[model samples]
Target chain A: MTGPDRPHSPSGDGTPAPRRSPWRPRSRQGRAGPLTYLVLIGVTVVSVFPLYWTLVAATRTNAEINSVPPPMLPGGNLMKNIDLAYDQIDLTKAILNSLIVSGSIAVGTVMFCTLAGFAFAKLRFRFNNLLFGLTLGTMMIPPSLGAIPLYMMMVELGWIDHLQAVVLPTLVSAFGVFFMRQYLVEALPNELLEAGWVDGASTFRVFRSIVLPIARPAMAVLGMLVFLQAWNDFFWPILALTANNPTVQVALNNLGQGYVPDRSVIMAGTFLTTIPVIAVFILLGRQIVGGIMQGAIKG
Target chain B: MFKARRRAGQGSAPYLFVAPFFLVFAAFGLFPILYTAWVSLHAVDLQNPNESTWVGLENYRKLFSSDFFWNALENTFTIGVISTVPQLCIALGIAHLLNYRLRGRTFFRVAMLMPYATSVAAATLVFSGLFGRDFGMINWLLGQVGVNPVDWDSGRWTSQNALSTIITWRWVGYNALIYLAGMQSVPADLYESAAIDGASRWQQFRYVTIPSLRPTILFTIVVSTIGAIQVFGEPLLFGGVSGHLGGAGRQYQTLGVLLYDEGWFNYKLGYAAAVAWTMFVIIVVAVLVNTTLARRRWRNAA
Candidate 1:
């Protein structure tokens, strides 16, 4: 309900978005009406059941898994599965490769996005609108359209099997820049910068002193998104990863071709793969949601 | 003097602040995409790059004439429509359920988003197990109702339908979270006013809530459409490594999968590039239609 050109209207008609329909509904926050906590909790259970299943399945032996109802409890074979996976696939190496590729891509994306976002959001340059529009317009340019050329470019650059091949291509994601710009546009207070300038603070000094601190929450959100994307990414890395520098995902895929469906190790690899994503989400779910909403509303 | 010093000190700062991105984007982002267009014009082969012949419109001609390309196009659209409409609609319903004065709402809200953050690889793996013909949970459930188990990945419709179910399940909750956010933004006073005016909950939703959520709905529609069109990982992982072939007998493949097959798997760089451009056009066109229709719905509802 925020208006760009106008002063804050709060919630459009002065209702202030109602503070989410009252946090607690009278009789008992525990249990009272048809709006019982159990129903919602049930939903929460359903949603997380698959994740729990993944963890459980990671522990079970293939035959135990093939049992009628499937085990609801974790099996003792988790360590064995991990050991087997390490033996068959380069589990440790794959994890390290994933970290390097995803970490580098995430860092590269943040740097490019923040820089471009800072330029677009704060610059008074001519054609700033045009540049931003062009950037935004490129958002609609599907990634597939860029795929063939990107592959050729990688081959030309001799980066095909290199982790750099994956990192370099998606470094300047439009969504990243767009998300950061929107966040900064909201978070940066013009008066502070103007005041800093009045007291002889340079633009860089003002930005450093005034903007970056306030932008941490937003940046963290963008950073998490960047990390999530890099982690979940399959295509470019699959194209890029060789036997030497295979990411976990590619390793798992290749594992399928290499073995006759070793469910124990596959489950282990999948579970290991999911951990980083879950950790990131646990830490920064709110920022992710907020940043995403901010980006969508404004952009 | 202070202002002058300030201006001088900060004169190049903005450019400095912004250069890293522009440089990287130029090198990796802009350059390759532009080169892809040039590549799309030629008869370039990844295996034999030196034998590149600049056959003008030849790649485009070949892509346009190919039956597989058309099939991919059709699959992409069909799957996108099937998945997107239901995904967003159910997402809206889930959002509403969450918005309703449900206890443990916060739990549901967060639970709903778990699917969104889940690795597509893991989820697809899980889904493939669930959709297994012999022992899938789905087939078991179907058998309890006395329906025969269908070969979920064999026939065109069955395969695409199975793929779309996974797509729908993964996405519906994600979209619901989006709708929940949008719903949270709508002024409760509007609902209050509607309530006061003898409008029932459903009517308030039909009249007030839906109207306020038009922009959000439009946003979701566009996002869902793009997401569906770019249906890569599911088909790639579950469908096959040779994703361009789409599905078994090429029935379940989307444009994204097809684009990969042509460009990377098959080495039909030029033809694949054309296919990519075709997808780009389709996505743009779909976005346009989504926006137009959303606006119309908003207006008519108003």
Candidate 2:
């Protein structure tokens, strides 16, 4: 059920626009003039300034940061501030915990969502459409609605302060399932499945040998999205895990709420917490942009 | 015999594929939600969640009468409008600009999305520093322009505006990209035809781009509305030590922060559940209203 097909090529990578012919009329999508560049540059600066300031604040002393006309440039105290942040809170443990938690969630969500999405997209089964609709419905449920009871459930299970407490509940994202289902519905072809069945392969066997390979790109995109979400997840993890055993976001929360409120140390922790995801973003920015655009059209 | 066995295997396979998601969701997702509805009907404390006293609609009754509840609802509405309206409008403009053929398109896109990549806690921490009373960058910039250094956290509108700025900064790029995707899908000939008919750039955008992107605009609005209702970590971490209170006057406390306050700080687990449920109801009503409006628009167009 393709809607309006994308006017651009299917790759949808941010390829440079082709050179316009001199004879052609200037349409709305014509080459941008000087004014567009000025506006875009302004927006980009606004976007990146906060993140850049995080680094600057992290490098300065509390007094320097709080002074009138605050220090716009970074100081030489970054390493020392980072060390102080480590002493103030369990920064190392928090980063390690975040890695474990987000890694497990990404892998788990990708695996489970791919399987369920494949079924919803292709297989004929009882209540297939209805179950798919139910999964979509779950996305609309505000996460706070389940927090109190989920917290109580964690308490009963003795999972409070445990990594699994945060990891387990989030491993099955409705959006992940929906995203995969949408991708597979279009990217996968029926003939491929028929060929696998004709070869007498078991469904699971076919899935492993055929579906998995086909789903790799979408899986990678979903994995990155899920990882970023889990890493940045605040509300649930703050509830389920304690400060003693915290993720990056939880540690940042503690840093912000500290009694003395060391601005440099807090900024250092915030910088440290954000760097890994930002690194990932830098390495895979184009793909992630494509993924969001692709998801937007499908969604 | 082989055919029959293969048919049997196929019959059970789809269920096997879907069972994991359903099982996990049943335990962690669906059950907890229904349990929250039940929890709201009782008097439960954070210290002793197991010992819940059934209070019927007492928690709901208290919520209706609570001034804090109304204040939070009002704050949520005001902040939602302030943040979302300007955010979407700016996003539309940025998306329109980005649609023009430009150099370094990838860099522009990735840079604009940097804020989205930043976690709420980190972003809020940085923005709070920028919005600080005496020595903040925003105030410092305003001072250079012959304006007084405004105390960002002192008044209702001021604090709310500060919070809205944080929300807008984080989300505008994201919504712009989504809008750009929608604009890209618009048939180029629609623009060509408009241009042939002597429509200028702004006229073409107003006439063609906006109409073609209605569904996409609606999608972003609905998503942003849901996010606005649950605006948590930004306000929670905005006011330093008294962050959970949203401000000294609780001026910018959203429903999300209020839920945390009722449960964790006040230790009223039951009342918090009631707030959570009420939020769920509001989201549902809002989404339904959006859908109805969209449907009516389509009918009139038809």
Candidate 3:
């Protein structure tokens, strides 16, 4: 990828571009005290050590985990422990179920939120502010308020033990709509939308062609957020689906809740379930953090 | 031409665009709230919901009188305060550090978020092992320091501490990132001017940064309070297998857990709905009270 046109193409001086900022809180740029580094490293270690411990315990036998001065490093029984977890619980099925549910939820939420967000952000309609305010108000209604009746409705719909019970209800999040609206209001230009109108494009056509590409970045962040929350959701899925149709979070809960719990197998299951999300974080860490911070500011 | 075309689709297109959200909300979100309110007034059993008898505030009465309900509320507040107070302070400190022109800033920022990114189930289970009575890392570490092994799962305060530790670990970074975003917006010249005045770093942080970050702090406090009131997964997993109703004596059961226990386990749908409504009322009141008090404090400080 390196070429003469590249901004950071190696100059004769052999120094890469100065990427660090000079406008941080402290005027003395690049002069962080050693204590600052030490504290940051300590925080990083504390943040990551529990997950590492999960891995360490998962790799060891239950006896090793339970013994005095438990094995702190990776052990050789990783495969055996994972196999036990897989056999005891249909771990693969849970993973597949989680993927399907979370994927549907994320995609559905993103689409619906984008459409509504575009309307509220750009399209002129009577009662627009009131409607958007209504959407915002829904965010305050705790999910716990609707739990019992929502479960009952699922049962009445004969959606019990179905992934749709978990997926469908959450497909249109209020926060998602609000987030997309805020982002699109800033990212999208009214002139571009007007240009579409002048070209005889219908609203839907304008959204499909002109707005979708521009909103892709915001949609990706919102989709990732919805996916992570859906993947990690527990209480509803636990109530909606039976053990045979468990999502990963529910499956992990079952594993952790077993009588005479096997520490190795539980840890192994935890590790397996978390790998997808951790992988997502590694890949989309910047976007996720950026989206969260943006959400806070706009919210 | 643009105005003419825009007027053409003004009749139904907007409604069509936003129909899905409203439709879904109507079906699942709005209807359920109304139904829960309706069911809260009746003696509804899970098995025979069709034949429920109207109780008419009886469930609310029973809930108010029940010791378990009050105990769960008390525990929820205790765990909420324990976890949220220190979490915000630490988050503020980390955010302050993060605002500095440090090396590998991006790496540190990303690393801090790993806790918030991890699923509650995974995080709780890992903590369970770390806080285990025997052969646990915390106990082992304490032993090295010539302290007694503390039982995290038993007793009242210790179990709450264990739960609070998990909640704090999971959320502190998230709040910190929010604070960091707020910090980045503060005019850099404020610090420069303060420095010119020879204000010490601590003094600058105390007077300048703290005052400037008031709105962000208020936002976090309201959000944390809302989140803390419904703290469920941590205690559920912390209670261990078959220990979902808090601890053995319901030592750490929150209102969220209480609703689950009453509705799912006890089949008292009516009572559970009452508990849910109570929690809703309490959250609204708490948020209002917090906002007013914080506003008053800000005025007094000024």
Candidate 4:
């Protein structure tokens, strides 16, 4: 994209885009460098190799897997495995359930977090420092620390079987608020708020109209992060929806947890579940990382 | 328009603005933990929540006396250290390599982070198949190199090895992206100037790259320490599902698994709460220490 975006380099009389030495160049000891390059490539392969293997392995049958060596390439029978997995976990219902759980969690967290972040950033108030400090301080506490009581409370409220049990408790996230506040405090201009106030605008109105529009990019990053965390969460759903309303991860866990497991079907299920999250990173990978860096730099 | 009710001396509404956070925190965050402590002081049973006795620090005493709890603590710390040190090193090194100017760097950058986007459950499942002793690829590859098969889940050290394998696979890429962000902030001009002064690559990196990445290193340490310390899924799954006690002798178990076992499996609410508090204390101390050290480093560097 960058190659075609610029027709010419400014260093010369507009000939064309500058060239490169393939993917990378090296010094005179370039031979030594490919070893380093090989190491880098090896690590990269090790990283994504499992994914490739899963894609290939999902299509093969158990007899093929249990051979002297595994199949090094893809095979047919993908449809058969998918059919088997559908009956095993009710793949359609599980996907819908996961969507509901992750979607509600993401949207709810963003709404509340944005509202609170706007208040902290644009609203004038006392005890703000102390409250924000405590908010930042809670990042230290691990989620497992409160698992037992949260479970008990959910049970007592009779919210155990509902999706709200998982969704409501997680709807308010500290990290999201912190990220949003960091963005809003800077991105929102003071003069705009002053003008709105002079025109008799309410605080909430000012925030809803002015601040939110400017903070959309950061909000996207926060929303994505929260969604991923909730999507990939294992502990909460496993405990909350152990038997009934099993999430995709829990259903996937159930497959391997059972006796006489169908490894091919499990692999197929694994491949299917990973698509949404992998797609997220593939699209917004840089922006997410950059957003994190910006927040951390300020923090 | 909400008017200021300052005649009664009531002040700011920021508390009102942030009420939802506090409410959720109090209900789910503070209340549960405080209740856990209260429950831990009493002898509560799952069958009868009403018929319980207040037994004060006895739960703590029992935990101290039990060798199973001690083994789980040891396993947690061992895996935490083993996985974190090398994981951060690899992350830092990869981030450095990634910071270099090259063609198609974005492909490698995004590709490197691909592992983290995969679900842990699926990743662990595949890793289990790979590390399986019989007909597993790792063993088969070892055989080609004239080495013998390793029973990965057979013993104590093997348990850590298996657990670390899963941890490294899941997190190494996530940390790399963060570190890549860190390495990018380091001005390229610093290195170019250092090169002009004939500073070797090793010297330039040691003086510039290492120092510049201090905050990121600290960030990773704080986060990785918290994560590894509270590791649950990989160990639990690797320990075998329904093998809730985490192996025959509680060998590979961490605090999260143990707490779950005590609370959910055995129905010992009070005892599990006590374990959770201990885990909380350990995490608190770690975060506090890292923050303090980070502040000092920032001050000295300034």
Candidate 5:
């Protein structure tokens, strides 16, 4: 198949056709008509408008934000509102807390999932299928079912208002293991392991040198996904931590639910919470897109 | 010597490698889920969780008899349908558009996914602001079209619709990309054959594309249904101050918010556990129903 990004040549091939056919089916697929572009542009606008409006609202004063036909354009109060939100809530601490929590969870999930996935995919062991099936089954079990007991456990452990309370429960996801296992099954060749075995390399050594290198791409993808999930996770974090110590999502929630409703300040807090992830998306979007598509095919 | 070393390594290496997951799952996952069942059978106060009185089936009975529980269930179902149906349909359309080779293909895909990158907290806050009863952009836009302003927060349908809109906005792009991946895998010759038979684009889409995308569509539907069943963050944040109650009249209280409200707000741990288990059963039933229906459809086709 031709690459999606390649432009459709008039002759419908890299080498010019001797003459164009009355109906060129192959190139026609590549040549989207005007209506298609119009629809796509419409969808794009709808997709982006809310985030854009968040920026607009964040820059305006509450009075301007609350005015009818609300300020479409940004006002000059961006920094002021941000400052107000910062003063009202410990946003900087929240961001730092989020980074630490998400970072640790991401690293932990990737490490544990890769190890488990490698074993599931390549190694032969007792109850291998049974164990792997259990892992997959766990994915179907909703996290909410465990909330009450987990909350009690957290309380018993004195982990309330602790970042670890939020981090530990989510440190290893069943989905991460499944994703890595799928990737490894396809990507890791058994011959490599056999070669290592023949070379007298222990399983751990082979894993460290050979498996890790081969699994790096999948690990990176899983890490990004887990980090995104950890960062955006609200339900557990809100339950575990209070306003005094909150992640970005928890802080944003507090800001939104503040007794004295300040729309602009809330929007400012929303903007602050969202921008870091958006910036990351902007930078690594292509890989993230690729990762999702790749996972879609396998999953 | 090497064979002996390899055998020794193989004997324990896999177990050691896989231990972390099992250990963590035992500690955090399996235990809690099982303990939730235990908790559900007892009346456990949030303040004194250790002290519990066994009230077998009482929480479930109370839930079955409670108006709020029923309201939340109804809200969850209605919101799930409204959100998932339109979201998937729009995603399929977007995917079709994306399949056609367009300039800035990467740009469009990445830009559309920005909402997915935005957290539920951020997205809900932004959407709630936009859907404000007064001075909101949506009402302003509707006013331009001679439509009356909508009290998006108060009314049952409006509030649910607003919550669903937030869900749709966040997920449509992600689902579109999933569908696009499926679309890309459809053999080009099918489309070519259809075109040669003088099929129009709409006909091609109707006959060729949708059939080819059955598994992908089913996958999205199941996934979306699972997500919708657990709809919490959007409704909770959308409620603003009384976030846990969903709305003043419980207009849009999803099962997830109900769980939170019962446990966190009302401090009824036993009742929340019942809600949680009920949700679990509902999800399992939903998955089974989907699977059975899909299998039956496939059998019929066969």
Candidate 6:
């Protein structure tokens, strides 16, 4: 973290000072001038406008969306659009399916990655660095490179339309392991594990009680990231899950591409699909931001 | 100094703890990739994959001569450069701005992540509507400026730009936040010293901040390059409703879309695997090149 004179650190007692030029370095509050705020606000509008547009369109009739100057405000047709989307597409089923797949992957990844991460961070084992490096290196291999054989394997196993086809393949995230290991190595002390071992607590017991409890905050961040990724995934879901078993993303795509594509209906479906991740983001904004930055900086 | 001895009980525990990943990764991650390489060398019919015949290098040979393959590679490079350059530049600027103590700091930071957290499928669907030729908001705005409405997804350059816009929109904020983190760690004292030496804001940023952020910049560029090359969902959605072919004339077909097309639609599993292998090679080479260039720059700066 930067010091008091740096940008983010608040001035003691939190009173607004006279406006200063952002170009001039301030020794006090370090607050940005008006110009900087103007630029940031503009950037935020551009960044957020599309989602706003989607919401506007989702709540409006098709004619309103197609108007020369599109309806800038949300309209009264939101429930109507939702009803049409629900009746035409299996919106509820797709959302439920997405929840199941994403939930399983998130929980599974957190548990598995944490266990391995604790071992790597705490225990002294043969080839520990080598194993950890291998895990890190695997991050470079994009899963898409194996699409053909994965589909074939799924076909061979008759898992083509099964949720596990999507879930099982993505459970072991290399980045998740790397991220958790880094956190654990920094957070949990060696003496704690040693104390548990000296007290004749089994390694599993120590990991279950001591490490897991302490590592909860790190796990929550990792779990949120993993869940968001699984929920937003498209290519694999489209390839694995057929029409009968569409995830929310797939279902939304189908709605968008249907024979008589209605913009409001599709937008309604898109809105429904996007809400969960956005809600998660809003709820855990600080943690998610920290998780992303920490992962990137460490890597 | 509390190093527990890895003797009787602890010896196998670490291995047991790590076994789940190895087991799952071998079966799912590593095995399938190796199997794909195996499949790349054979002429495999999707309908009857068991009857795959070894064709050793023929798929590669065909892939090299194929117009579609070359077109896809060209499109991928075109869009990757277009998207990557501006995405990083804009992200750098945004990070610079955010580094200052603005009012509503948390609100702006959280707002920056909104685009990143949205699903690609959903984002693309919204974007496609916006980029639509006739009644789109983009075209509507352009008309106000006395410009004709252009068909975005039809032409090669236009479609590529359209897809690049989608990629840039989704990733810019994420990258900006990363750069912001790097900026925060740049030792604020350096800026203080630079300012004391009577350096202007621009000069201080150019000389001090940029130099300090070299490693972070390199890190982001390499990762972005890899992600850009393997861009899938944007092009896939932009391609059309059903076809994995990038466009009517394969205009915006990236390497990812090409791989999917060859495998699923054409049932040319062997050739698709070749495409996948080729993409993997290109990414590895690109990463190597980026690291070497960045390291050389670091050396020169030092």
Best prediction by TM-score: 2
Second chain TM-score, each model:
0.91, 0.95, 0.94, 0.89, 0.94, 0.94
Error of 3 at B37 (Å): 1.7
- For residue A203, give model 6's deviation from the true position in Å: 1.3
Model 2 per-residue lDDT tens digits across residues B136-193:
8999999999999899987999999999999999999999999998988887768889
Candidate with top DockQ is 2
- Candidates in order have lDDT scores of 0.70, 0.87, 0.84, 0.74, 0.86, 0.84
Q: In candidate 5 chain B, where is summed lDDT lowest over 10 consecutive residues?
A: B1-10
Off by over 4 Å in 2: A1-8, A11-19, A23-28, B1-9
- Local lDDT at A111 for model 5: 98
Q: How close is candidate 4 to the true structure, as a TM-score?
A: 0.89
Task: State candidate 6's TM-score.
Answer: 0.93
Interface RMSD of each: 4.5, 2.5, 4.5, 5.6, 3.6, 3.1
For model 4, the superposed segments whose C-alpha errors exceed 4 Å read A1-37, A86-88, B1-13, B47-52, B291-302
Q: List the residue pairs that clash in candidate 3.
A: none
| Candidate 1 structure quality by residue, lDDT tens digits, A29-107 | 1123465355556656767877787788789887776666667799988998888877767877888887887788887
Looking at model 6 chain A, report the run of 10 residues with the lowest lDDT sum.
A1-10
Candidate that beats the other on lDDT, 2 or 4, i.e. the better one: 2
Q: Estimated TM-score per prediction?
A: 0.88, 0.95, 0.93, 0.89, 0.94, 0.93
lDDT of 2 by residue, A1-299 (tens): 01222233543223343555575444347778999999999999999999989999999998898887788899988998999988878888999999999999999999999999999998877789999999988887766569999999889889999999999999898888888898888778888987888888888988998899888988998898889888989999999988899999999998887774677888899998898789889898887777777778744
| Cα lDDT tens digits for candidate 5, B54-158 | 999999999999999999999999999999999999999998888886888888899999889989999999898889878888998999999999999999999
CAPRI band for model 4? acceptable
Report the lDDT tens digits of candidate 5 across residue range A1-299.
12212133111234344354655655435567899888888888998999898889899999998887577898899898998898778999999999999999999999999999999999888878999999988877777568889999998999999999999999888988888887788778888889988987888999999999988988998899889989999888988899999999889888877774678888888888888788998898887887787667633
What DockQ do the predictions score, one after another? 0.37, 0.61, 0.45, 0.37, 0.54, 0.53
Error of model 5, residue A221, in angstroms:
1.6
